[model samples]
Target chain A: MSAAGAGPGSREGHREPRRAVDGALRADTADTADTADTADTADNPGLAARVTTRRGGFTLDVAVEVAHGEVVAVLGPNGSGKSTLLGTLAGLFDPESATVTLADRVLTDTDAGITVPVHRRRVGLLSQQALLFPHLTAHENVAFGPRCAGQGRRAAGAVADRWLAEMGVAELADRRPSELSGGQAQRVAIARALAVEPDLLLLDEPFAALDVDAAPAVRAVLRRVVRDSVVGGQTVLLVTHDVLDAVVLADRLVVLADGEVVEQGPTAEVLARPRSGFAARIAGLDLVTGTACAGGLHTLDGTLVSGAASEPLDHGDPAVAVFAPRSVAVHRERPAGSPRNVVPVRLAAMEPQGEVVRLRAGASGRGPAWGEGLAADVTPAAVAELGVEPGDELWFAVKATEVAVHPSGR
Target chain B: MTRAAPSSPRTRSSRTGSTGHTLPWPVWVPAVVGFGLIAVPVAGLVLRADWPNFLTLITSDAALDALRLSLQTGLTSTALCLLFGTPLALVLARSDLPGLPVWRSIVLLPLVLPPVVGGLTLLFLLGRTGPVGQLLDAWFGVTVPFSTVAVVIAQTFVAMPFLVVSLEGALRTAGDRYEAVAATLGASPMTALRRVTIPVVLPGLVSGAVLAFARALGEFGATVAFAGSLQGTTRTLPLLIYLDSQDDLDSAVALSLLLVVVAVVVIVATRTRDASGVR
Candidate 1:
């Protein structure tokens, strides 16, 4: 994704790009280095599950695959069957007709009626709520899985101690859930999940409920854990609503809308060329639907906006042009440059975006009027030099190469 | 943090004085009557208790026999309630068995039924010449009436509802959240029940047991109706108090005070137990 305008805390605001790069690097290493030895298919090391479940009025039908050591993000809007997919993989619900194979081990085969129980599935699900056993101390909570798997008390305690240290919550071992902070509880939950040595780990918005100040620390721990597990053959599936989460942790993106997989590709590739409004919105890009022509597109606003497409499009084909706010140049007057397209618009609002300023320009020089608009992210210094304000008339320019045009889907 | 909503300063200042403004008589008067109705009788019972010779009267052979029998039967009755009531509570609270509402109503029958009526129902099932009782007598040579075991059974008949209802409410409130999580953590259903579910609802179970024991200790009508009053066998503390009222007023008051003290102890012990285990 195009980087978000760096906020006042510029380093933290730019966390997504830096993390996505690291994840991509690790993913590339894992893919090329170890594509052998599954005792079945040396080429395929990923776990695949084709889930189809009907609950209430929503029918969830999606196929998900995560390569060994690869982290895939199941990003979706609310009520998009994210939980249903995770629950079915974790063996909480039996899918109608599906096959779930994790590292060559079939966990669920509906046609064969071979559905392993939750405890036997060897799938670890850490939810938004920590769901720690309240009566158990952090250490005991971590030890529960090993103990249930027939370990002695001392052996289980040792296993718990090791994971607790690994999770960076070693000091919180004796503390109860109520005595622990939200982030601390979540870390312990992560340790608990790992102690089970699950083949497929489902992290369901583990940071969603955490405090803003604590999310970074938890995110760091999670990244380290996922990075370290590359050699251990553990596949991770992260379910999140936040694009930053997907951008930072997942190497691949699987976008779900209304219980269907709308898009799936490499994280950066899919993010840079979103086909849906939800995807574009999360990526923080302005999505303009236009009629594709030879060179660029003709927008519905009765204007010509020139942009490049990754692939050539046939004339009159419905397409979308996605561009970042930072790509737009805000000016007091029309400037002569190499810019391919320029639109005259009135400033609807100017919002402070960290070190940068984002100007919302619309057709009317009034507060948030109804019309086609462009979101322009410019430097605070530039805004001050131009003295931009609400209801100001201005012209914004964007190079054709900055906008990526792609075929729009129903 | 509450958002500071804009409001008139005068209105806020007036609201500060509203707490000082007494409640309307209609509301206050009925509330006082509700409190007084329950408090007045217990207060009178305490005030009328025989202070002098209370210890001496309770220590007498007849009173001692009844007190010992009541304690023994009450303990056994509460033990039985816990043994049976726990599973019943689990089934009622956790399962989705058909006819659940009807079964729940049937289970609550003893709670509202008169003690004498409950005793009669038990008699129909277990009394001599009764179907089950006849089978027991012919096969095992067991006669229930006028026996200490009968006293325990009668007390259980009258008091088991209190235990079951309390436990069911506890189990329902606790829910199966811990159990579900524990299963996902690799604990089998039975192991989860013992390790997670039981510990989570321990306070409820304790309170229920205490209430059942208290009810059993004071039971009189059911014991008299079903078990029959035989001194040192079925004559519990309440029966002793009823018997003493005819000849020894002082002993009757002393026995009543003892029952009240024991019930208070049970309540306080359970309260402390709950306070100590705050799950």
Candidate 2:
């Protein structure tokens, strides 16, 4: 909303003022523009949402806040209440507590004793499957939303055409969904959702089913359309398993595990420092638990290693050291290196992992106290140059800065 | 795509014998037996049909009245069934309503119930002295029993469930995902039903409607029991056939052939409509 931080790729850490300015400016501009057209109605801001469900000994409780022009990604592992959150938000799953609000409008507030019917809520939802009406052509499908909004046939058709054109799918307007490619159908679904001009937009893994190549293109188009919504403020919520997608489009990442928010923060920060093992896995990191001391960090398995001290260390305080696989430098012998933390370890195994070869190494004298063997991901070229092999004694250098140490509670 | 090369007579015979190993007797044998069983009724209808007197039999006043009434009531019942049943099917198949299993079972009850039972039930509920019937008679002073309306009601009571059950299955299989997509586009539930749900399940709905209509036209036990076999009133073609069979078998056979022909024509027309609708 504020223009202060509009500069591209400015990495000023903790730019709260700039972010606040931008957010305020954007919100103000949208507010003024919407009021000019829609008469500044109190019901305009829509509602905020929350859902809690318990079934078969599993509890799903997700609380989500959606702002206009912003896309909130609900990220979690499978069975982590992502879809449940989306469904609850969409008014499909009735929650015991309810408490879903939009703008100032109460969608489902148990305390207030209100539960709006789904059809009357004016919220639009897109699922993994586009679910376009198979019997209708693209144009007809687009027109369907406006028609449902009580527009006349001709008016709805015109609106549908405008949306179809906006989606860049006008050329295929006469084609049915069965005749469409996966990406095209999703685009049409988006266009249909837009045509209705819903107060809230709910997407449940809209791109999860798409091929990798198709997902990015569809996501780009979706982001563009969502950015240009006519509603003074449109709330967008996405539930997805793809972490990269959350990082790419979401303003905030809400990580759910076992139906609870394990971690949540700005997209970049959350990706950088995931708070839980599930969050770390989602962010593509391996989490290991250990302890720290003045000499070095000691593993529960009794393996001691020289590493950066996260805190002013006491004799034996519990801690965790997280290092990227790429950060661990493997050497055939004790090689001279600029890196400070070096440990003698035996290569446990080697396996090809995508573009790199991942090496698993264990310290000789008792393994890391509580953690498993440390893993190092290196390129095939690095593996070949180092002559790294199983059973070989090697010196691995882990830079102090690369090692992210945190106090361990467990 | 290429055709198999022609084999020598002995080789073909040997190939045929060997093919038996791959194909089981239960599959082809039952198919053959079913076809033969179906052919028997057709062969009887054709062989026994007096073509020269067919026109006379059909043109008879009683037969003509019965045929007209059958077509009229059957069509009316089918139309009512579609109007009410399709949406009911959509609700049963799509909504997450509590007690859905119970509602589904209720909708399908008529399908398995004997038509005579359905007619009797309708008679009890809609008869002149019945609860609803008493109110209708008190307000409108209209008696429905032994009338064309009674025949239509009897047929609808027996036949509507067939359309609803088939269409419900189709709706369930097709899913409500498309309806959700439509809703996101600002379509109300009703609009979504009319524009998306109806068209998506058209093939199933049409086929089911036709089947119901055919069933309605041939309904006899129910019509006779509830609406009564009154001449030029509730005497549908099936009722007439049943009545005529008591006096003349040839006339009954002629009426049966006519009904069969009509069913075949309706089926062909429906298939044609379905094929074009898909495209």
Candidate 3:
């Protein structure tokens, strides 16, 4: 029942905070700087939390910090504890041992036995579904938080109207939840969450239930509100599956995998030079982990991947070579004259990616050691001409200049 | 095999209806017969009523007093059921308390227990020589047996299970998704219950109360056993009807029709509210 034993396996794979590449933002350095700068000051940085909780068979052990008026997007695949992290922060779910400090307020400190109840936490949450109160009109739904906070009826209605207008749903104020469309309902939900002026906002995939046409508009509204609404300097923790949301709305990106933080940095920097396999996959780049060699890296499977060094590395230091799928050329035979890196692979699957067919290739032969291979984006005409099917022995060639070698934290 | 032409919209519609029909033809015969089994008795009750003297028969002082007492006790019992049974239903449906199925079964015992047994159960606890009755008699010299309060207590004993079962089903179906949302919006537990939980299940509450009222109005065996049929004091409409039926058949039938009409009105009112789909 102790916190140390809560997640025995988490610490074993917990690597030291990965060093950022050249021209990249390092979270560790920034955290230290913020700490040093705010040591004696009364100014509080928004939210700093260390959460360790286990639900069912899954264990989530993570530490996260967000500055005031900052939006940190948590990106992860399903079952990666993204929602659990938000729940822990919002006080909807209890954590075994957690220190969640928001806006200089000790919301949760299990050591101190000061776990604030959800209603008193002042952490507004906008879940995937709108989840508006069915019996209330849009205006009343928005007014709910204010009323709960003991506002007068007239004052609450005024606040509701203001928020409704802010979310562009003022005209739908009197309409009940059932009368509003999906987009309108979501807009009302956003207004309801913001009406509280919470110290921290927890958004769990708010745009996920929205249609493509609605998603962009909602995302834009969220971007505007999260950035422009600095009245309370609200710190927002947004959990999302879409990379575009991170790109558009977030100031930083925290990538989670298997209930642990894999990588985190400034959004653009992490997307550009992702260290974890999960981040690389979401960024649509192929990452090959290996040992630093003369030019690039020697993969575990003995494939010498040559690429330009994006970060400094010592001899035999652990490193990774990253390349885009479009940089790879598929050949029937090993016919790479210019490209230095060539590997013999077996076609695993072919998926159409808009204008091109993404041919996924893995290690050839019946070896149990199927190295995470490369994805090659070839034109459909080229695929038809090559007549390639799954299990076909193919040669994947990548130009050395296309790949970027960097020192990996692992 | 000969085939009919796929001709008119009318024929096509009929065939489509046949295609959609999942049950066999024989099922309809038994279903209709089952419907008649319930409907025919009510038809007979209407047909057997002495219409010419209906006003005179139902306007007697005993009849009026019984009717008034039935309404008063039924309403009070229904209110009591709502006040007590709502929290019980909420606990049974929402709380994570262990051994809840046992508690739920115990609460629903009145539904399955015969009315006479239920009356005896209440009597043993509250009768003059019983423990609670003895305490009351010793402390306040207040006798509860064979009183109007006894009638209400017996009615609530047998009728509250309906309210509990109905409201519990509604609470379970409505779920806590809205309640969770309300909590996130800064609503405390009480506020969420008053605003979100109660409002969401208002229709169910109304229907459950109506059902409890109807059952209380029709209570006879429990009332007769626990609170003897004293015309103006302990006797309700059903007890009066039972008493009058022994000798005055005409008044008994008229009272019976009045009870039926009241039950129908209660049921119809609830139906109209449900049909309106008012939150």
Candidate 4:
């Protein structure tokens, strides 16, 4: 444990010291106040990064911050520059322009011509693959970081054992990555990354490869480690597509779409009131962007969507109408009903969700479609009763009270 | 002892007397001819070998010396290949150096060049009258041509390309993701290569070394052209066999059989090791 503290980046040691108090998952700390270069840790207290890069047709420009001891999850769809952001932060991907400051260190500043090497950045990355050295056992894999930092063989082994115990994989210390299951290997990989005692831990879809049965256990392990990291004042940045990952692990959410930050807020707030199409889709909410009018909101196509304002908004201000799919009812024809908001739509797609079938309607399918992203949820029995298939001309009826309008946060 | 029949009797019955491996009828003709083109020469040598005197002919002093020198020089050249070629392979596969394609083409020259041309190139570089040879002569009164060291150099010149090409392909296939992961784990580039890259590609290195050793052992034109056939001094098994054929054909045939045995053993051993080493 003491040897683990002897990292090339002593700053990393200060961030996460090896602890062994509990049987295998000890919660202990080393008191080392040699914070000479870390004077700004209290002022900025976390990570501030602005990265921009262009490769071929794709361009990524993003700025994000994480408070000290906070976990910020970067949520994005595939090819949305999540990997680029993490790569630039970890110093693996060179950026055309970037200013990255973690705690007290300026890791990268293109204007200053300063780019910290990947190994010296003290930014540990746990990618989708565990990527443990195939030749090394779990114990040796964990010891590698300490050994690279100039610790003696015995000292590195001691550090490895302590970290392995902390990760609750002490019993698997002798097994190679090939012998370990996905969950076990990921656990060992976590220990290997933490053995370096990095200042920032970046998790890139750490549970994407695990099975449903194995993911929850790994998520629990990560939750415990993230909590420990918070106690040690270490910052964590998670990149994931799963809303559950953001809900369970992150303090803040930064949603990216098309290589830009489309929305970001507190995790709970963003989940409840997502502004971006990607965010709303993951949150299972239907969002239509328009301008607030006297009656409700007017879409760019001049279709009126009547709804109650969830927040105060001025007339002509950009607003969004949000409603759950379950709140919308599908009808074969315009019926004289209490629902005031009814629009003609063509069924575009259908997908089964646990107990209900979700039917989506788009503008391309049929007659005078009002909106493209309208959806409704109905039970299988209701679907059979309707006898609908894709391309069917349908009317989507929603009560004005069902839609909630709020400022678009544009 | 009674045994249970295979559960899928219909499938087993259909597979009777057939191993489930078949190629089109046209392929067997050229396949057999191509294999015979390689196998017939060794069959001829084995058939023509003086069986009663084969042991004594190969165990002769000059034959034994040539065998020893060939083994020694082949091993030394293989060692040299591994030492110098591994880094060259890494650079060719991983480095962003300008004109790397041209450099890789130059490194692969030995693979396609005639062994005589390779020998002549080495001679021009390291011969006594050559640039580097003149320096060695002036500085240390050393003569490289017609020496055992010259045999090793010629063999290494012709054999190293195999090692480098094999290893570079392995490096390319393995990719750098693991090294990047190691770097993030605080491993320096050199450390990552030593601990991660090298271990991951150990099978490639072993197979490459074996290929180089076999090529060095069989090197004929290069060793003869550069290092003259001086018995017990520079002549290797190939040179000895050539010289033996000028007089005693039995000795030459026996030695050829020895090389065939060595080459077969090396190739078979490498194939099995490769099969097991690769996950």
- Tell me, by TM-score, which candidate is best: 3
Evaluated on chain B only, what are the TM-scores of all the candidate structures, in order?
A: 0.87, 0.87, 0.90, 0.89
lDDT of 4 by residue, B162-263 (tens): 999889887887788889999998889989999889988887788889989999999988888889899988999999899889998889999999888878
lDDT tens digits, residues A1-410, model 4? Answer: 01112101222332332232113321212221221223333454577788888955688888876656667788888898999999999999999999888878999999999999999999999987788887788999999999999999999999999888877889999886766877888888888988888889899999998778877677767766766542375578999997667766776678888887777655645665455657867768666767888768887678789998754568997666777889989999886869978888888788787799988886754433345667789999999999999998888888999987755532
User: Each model's number of backbone clashes?
Assistant: 2, 26, 0, 0
Candidate 2 structure quality by residue, lDDT tens digits, A270-360: 5544546576566664334456776566665676655665445456755556667778888876668577666667887786868988776
For this target, which candidate reaches the highest DockQ against the unseen true structure? 2
DockQ for every model comes to: 0.21, 0.25, 0.22, 0.22
- Candidate 4 at B17: error in angstroms? 22
CAPRI-wise, candidate 3 is incorrect
Clashes of 1: 2
Give me candidate 4's TM-score against the actual structure. Answer: 0.73
Q: What does candidate 1 score in Cα RMSD to the true structure?
A: 12.7
Runs of candidate 4 exceeding 4 Å displacement: A1-44, A228-233, A285-410, B1-40, B265-279
Worst ten-residue run, lDDT, model 4 chain A?
A: A1-10
RMSD of each: 12.7, 13.2, 11.5, 13.8
Off by over 4 Å in 3: A1-42, A229-233, A285-376, A379-410, B1-30, B277-279
Sorted into a CAPRI-style docking class, model 4 comes out as incorrect
State residue A358's C-alpha deviation in candidate 4, in Å. Answer: 9.3
Stretches > 4 Å off in candidate 1: A1-46, A229-233, A285-410, B1-35
lDDT of 3 by residue, B105-149 (tens): 999999999998888877888899999999999999999889999
